[model samples]
Target: MSRMSTPAESLTRPDGSPIRVLVVDDEQTLADLLASALRYEGWEVTTAGTGRAAVRLAQELTPDVIVLDIMLPDFDGMEVMHRIHGHQPNVPVLFLTAKDAVEDRVAGLTAGGDDYVTKPFSLEEVVARLRALLRRSGASAEKPANVLEVGDLRMDEDSHEVWRGEDEIHLTATEFELLRYLMRNPRRVLSKPQILDRVWNYDFGGQANIVELYISYLRRKIDKGREPMIHTMRGVGYVLKPAVAQ
Candidate 1:
């Protein structure tokens, strides 16, 4: 007898709606199976068996995340991704491919895929990747407070305004949320896994370098010409605290 997989507990939106996901694959059985697993995670799942259908459904469904197969029946997966992006530019995409070559992965990422998984992958890994993508893109269900402050940096969640000392700093929504997470836990050493879980809301199975990338972005905007408050604990994690006197 086949083992039955249990659905993992997941977070829901403020309105209690499940996160939306679009699964695209030329193989009908694969698409349905993937959709079933996603639905098991308590997400709203839509499936498309062709690239053109995927693009059309993406527009109509406006899913929070998309799982796209690199190979398609009617059109190239990349072209489908482009078409869908034309309508919903910020929707996160995870490419599914049978090709495991570096070039294929690089091509998919270069074409604006947020992440990807090679074929013959476990369903649990796919779900985790989707969760991380949603978290990084601010598509997660949990919403923070209206304002957050740490040191001289202030972020007004309502107006989406950020200020460092006397100057106002502009940040993208993702950056703002990352900063808020850091500010919320001042002086605490947060490892990459911890940051991924708390800030991105996923247990990432890939590289942790994304954390470093966002940290550098925050430093340039928040620490430039000021006492640096974001500190790296070397092989541990990161800490945010007040800078000391010179």
Candidate 2:
């Protein structure tokens, strides 16, 4: 019920062994605890105290999954994820942060994070979420036609096409990326800065309205003449769901 419909799970290789993982946190103790828990779950684990070290370690280790902290030294954790993703696109990221705000969660998700957990969380919960993230990440992503259906709207990853019933929708590169990101997440609210960081670039420099502007553009093309599929959650961010006929 919680899992999204992305093909990320099928991307797993048949190693039939523990998946290697990297954990990055400024707080070394928390990092160690998480690493220990992951190791207990039969996953090989590595730890990084700084973002630069995390990137270098990720490059060297080629871990299957990453447990990344949003706050870091050397570079932003978002940038670290981006750099690591460039080397390994399929690796899933589970974000660890002290910021428990809805907007922060939105930012992480939009930044391509598979999951998030606020600080002072249980070791068991962290382990469980990391496993789920890995499973989702392992899912196959080869075919863009592996469409993720949220409601009435369907997005084709293979063809980069979106459809609302009989209507064929065209999207710009950025729009498609935005939609794809939202689709990958299903019901999660995504923030503008996070959207900028992940969909645009890790070092993205732009106004927050870039997200609002693109949202307007997308709604015009994808939601016009139909019930609203995308919604604004007030001070939080944006979430995409099925269009409910009122």
Candidate 3:
């Protein structure tokens, strides 16, 4: 199953600019993953692998929020937060800690960290936490709605409900996830590997067939008796777009 999902609402700064985010983690892969996830929400993201770099970037960007790893090469996240607070006092900080680091969690919160997520956490969880922090800090202007639509098809992410025009549609958990990913990037061709990574959370070896199988499943339910909104691009990939009126 996928660990990430589209946010219900896209948030921006009060000036309608992308919400600036600073992601600080010594683990390059994790940092890049987090940065990608945040950017998908239409936020501007910058990453730093050291506490010193984090402090410097925070000063340069004045990010609306920070995702700081508790462990860093130069210094701990606490010191980075302290250094940054010296300048941008109100910027929200979300700490990343080890799963078993109870002391670190306590210490981080006590040291004025806005929130914390343990390692092995989902991208969705981190995004949700950051959104909450942004709202609490008055740093976000949210465009409201949990529903995603393309053509006459609509999905309510919060309610787990889907509809084709006035008719409701039912889907299995995997099918729902696959459709959600397609809906999220309407009209963009999604390669089999991209679909697998986003919906299944990992590569299925070279078995890109799983993506094809699920795409077929979604097509049967979503386009069986209606104008087809899901299309295949030969060897390229799949795309979802508004159905042309007959």
Model 3 CA lDDT for position 182 = 93
Among all candidates shown, the one with the greatest lDDT: 3
Write out the backbone clash pairs for model 3: none
Local distance difference test, each candidate: 0.78, 0.72, 0.81
- Would you list the rank order by TM-score, best first? 1, 3, 2
TM-scores for all candidates?
A: 0.65, 0.55, 0.57
Clashes found in each candidate (C-alpha, N, C closer than 3 A): 0, 13, 0
Q: Candidate 1's residue-wise lDDT over 1-246, tens digit each?
A: 122277656856446788999999988888888888887788899998898788889878888889999998889889998999888877888899999776777577657677778888888778877876775566775544467777777776545578887899865445666787887788788889988777656554555766787788789988988889999999999998877632
TM-score comparison, 1 vs 3, better candidate: 1
lDDT of 2 by residue, 1-246 (tens): 022222223233345655788999988877777776666665678999998999899989888778899999778889998888787766778888888666776687566566677886777666666655544343223334487777778877765567888788866445667788888887788887777676644322345655786788789988888888889988888988878642
Weakest 10 consecutive residues of candidate 1 by summed lDDT: 1-10
What lDDT does model 3 reach? Answer: 0.81
